[model samples]
Target: MRLEPDVILANRLADAAGEVIRPYFRQLTSVEAKPDRSPVTAADTAAEEVMRRILKQDRPADGVIGEELGFERLGAGRIWVLDPIDGTRAFIAGRPIFGTLIALVVDGQPVLGVIDQPISGERWIGQIGSWPSTTLNGRRVQVRPCRALAEAHLATTSPMLFSRSGHAAFARIARASRDTILGGDCHNYAMLASGQLDLVMEEGLKVHDWAALVPVVAGAGGVMTDWRGQPLRLGAMGAVLAAGDARVHAEALERI
Candidate 1:
């Protein structure tokens, strides 16, 4: 497989972030609450800083949308989205599931993405077009099929993030699926991409939260959509679903 400039740079971006985030996990680091009451930490800011500095030097003309720093030069044809520590709560608690997310969106679509777990040194790389599908480390990976909801292994971060209107839809899926686990954050999506998870549904996501996930899941032969079963974009309404099998994704969409 040929490596594009975005893919090569995205790998380095994740590495730079990991270097900054590793020293803070499980250690006494400053944790602060955002205006919205979400928890953030020095690690989150520091990691994003590292990534942003690299992007400025390497992809200077490209735009950036970062979780900690907000948007910059965002109208450019190619934009980089960064979520340095996707599961900040998990990171704070020393859960290895937390990941650094980086995505390159060009012409409004994500063409390249990386999900990196700094502690474990595990990276999932995904890209658009017709070549390599997806990979964990250096090996190929793909999502598994589950035709029926009764056979699905569903996962989510939490029901607490579900919107009031989305609750019944979520309940229906939870009742139908064979198993469900809460609080995997982006790890659940990575697992779904690797065929270990059959389905993942979540609400209340920002673009930075789910942008990288689109290619990761799709390149692995899965489907990711909004609650209405449409493709994801930068300004989506936050309700999202990812499924390994095409049939199951359609079935879940109908139920939602």
Candidate 2:
């Protein structure tokens, strides 16, 4: 139907988060560790706070699942998933590759997604509906085709995130692909959607991590799913894969 309002609100949320995060980029001096030992800076918490406040005022009936902050309105059916900074390590290292991920999931399916890199002033928006497409800064983009997995360029945030068994599984895909690059968190998916990269496979992602990626990748003519080749949903496993070409995706799945 008409998703214009939601889309506008999503953009507003990204804009607000970016404003909050920009000030702390390279100036951030302190960081705290979560039980998982992941870094959380004031920037992350502040960015999520601003987005959450805006959502509460603009779409109070909707739910929110944020990385820095916890869940809100879990049963609201229409949820906004937020990852203030998908690449905290990259962000802490003064890298501009980190992104703020915002997603609109309705009934467990992600219908809208935005990957915004404030430092680079780049945004990728994707929507699924009667007409499905992805745009980067208002320009439509599509994934490039790859004839075979041997010719595909692969990327993953890091192999360290995977368990022993998972690492072995990903090693198979890495060996089969043309080349594999490390350290790109959510940016790799954005690159895949924009035809810069071919595939991104990683493990140990949460719902907020992969939810927004589904629409962004799919709308750009790519396929994003769990390691088993199943469509990603609300509660899917953390192991995720995104491939620009379905043929390459299928081939990678077989290897995984």
Candidate 3:
């Protein structure tokens, strides 16, 4: 099926952002540390600017919250959330796992999402009231049904964000799962939506990091929640778990 209108627009912006990011992936002349100590590159700021311009042109009534430009409150019911380059570190390292993230949040709930992985030529999109799917070079895809934790595949972006207890919790969860993949950033969430991955749990995320993913996972017949099984909210950093099935999410969260 063709993508919904909002999703189609998001995909367009994602592709634009991807185009801006591609040339800078491995060609960065320098990297600077932000006040928060996280690294930023020219690619990050440039891609975000491209996306923001597209959004502002097409959806003037909608507000936007972006990693680079901060937030603009349009006071509209719909807001676009953007992470121009989700895995900048991986991109700078010349890895193929980085991507652009975009989502439309209405009434504080994410209703549409798109993740574009340029190197992989993959695009995953989801909208509320529809099943989430991936378009790999433009082909439909769905999440896998891994019903139990013992047979599930797991992934986390980083283990360092977790405290000693958090790390132990992650280790325990990893031991319970059948397999684990690490370090894919937002790409991992796309993998989950495509059924290639089963679960991803992590802590320490911004709205830009998690918002775009919520609709993608949930719309695909999966679940995305905080550790306590609550729906995720923007502007807060906490535990996040994305699972292919609800039962697997419950089981995995128990271990964490």
Candidate 4:
């Protein structure tokens, strides 16, 4: 299928943000803690600024909510959600797992999403009412079929976000799954959408963190929900569990 206009725009924004991030990918002089103690680097601010500018230029009427700059309500019934570098800690440490995230939210629901890994030169895009697909240098890819949670591979953006109950739930699910991996931020969700990975469970997310991922996973014929099995709506509180297929997601949620 020809890419939808919004999806194309999302990819363009991802590429533009990647251009801003690539030069500093491995050349960070130092990293410091934000007031909240989360890691931050020059790359994050610069890339976000680049994306913000592109959105303002191309969709001047739409609102924008970015991790670094917070929110701008433009009253246009559309919003661009951004996480310029989803794993800044990993990026600053010289890991190639970081990626840029963008989502077009209409009336508080994400309709278009993109995740780009500049170091890997891969982009994943998903839109409402369309099949999710990945592009490695612009070639299409689909998610793999893993129908059972016991057969699925699992990943989490962070292990520490789990509570005692949450951790136990994760452990139970992990024990049932084929394998578990860690620490890819938005990349893990992209992998699940592309069928390279089966499931990713994460807690303590800001809307910016998961908004771009929801459409990407869902468009790939997968399912994404809060732990309660509710559809993932923007601004919802609690953990997120995304799976490559509904059956696998149901089974995994049962174990959790």
Clashes of each: 0, 0, 2, 3
lDDT of each: 0.89, 0.92, 0.83, 0.83
Error of 3 at 79 (Å): 0.8
- TM-scores of the models, in the order given: 0.97, 0.98, 0.93, 0.93
Which candidate achieves the best TM-score against the true structure?
A: 2
Better of 3 and 4 by TM-score: 4
In model 2, the clashing pairs are none
| Winner of 2 and 3 under lDDT | 2
- Tens-place lDDT digits, model 2, residues 60-177: 8999999988998888889999999999999999999999999999998999999999999999999876334899998999899998999999999889999999999899999989
Q: Which pairs clash in the backbone of model 3?
A: 132-219, 144-195
Runs off by more than 4 Å, candidate 4: 1-3, 132-136
Model 3 C-alpha lDDT per residue in residues 189-220, reported as the tens digit of each score: 98888888999988878888888888788777
Model 1 per-residue lDDT tens digits across residues 176-225: 88989899899999999999999999999999999999989988988889
The C-alpha stretches of model 3 lying farther than 4 A from their native spots are 1-3, 132-137
Residue 215 of model 3, lDDT score: 77
In model 4, state the lDDT of residue 66.
92
Q: Candidate 1 regions off by >4 Å?
A: 1-3
- lDDT score for candidate 2 against the true structure: 0.92
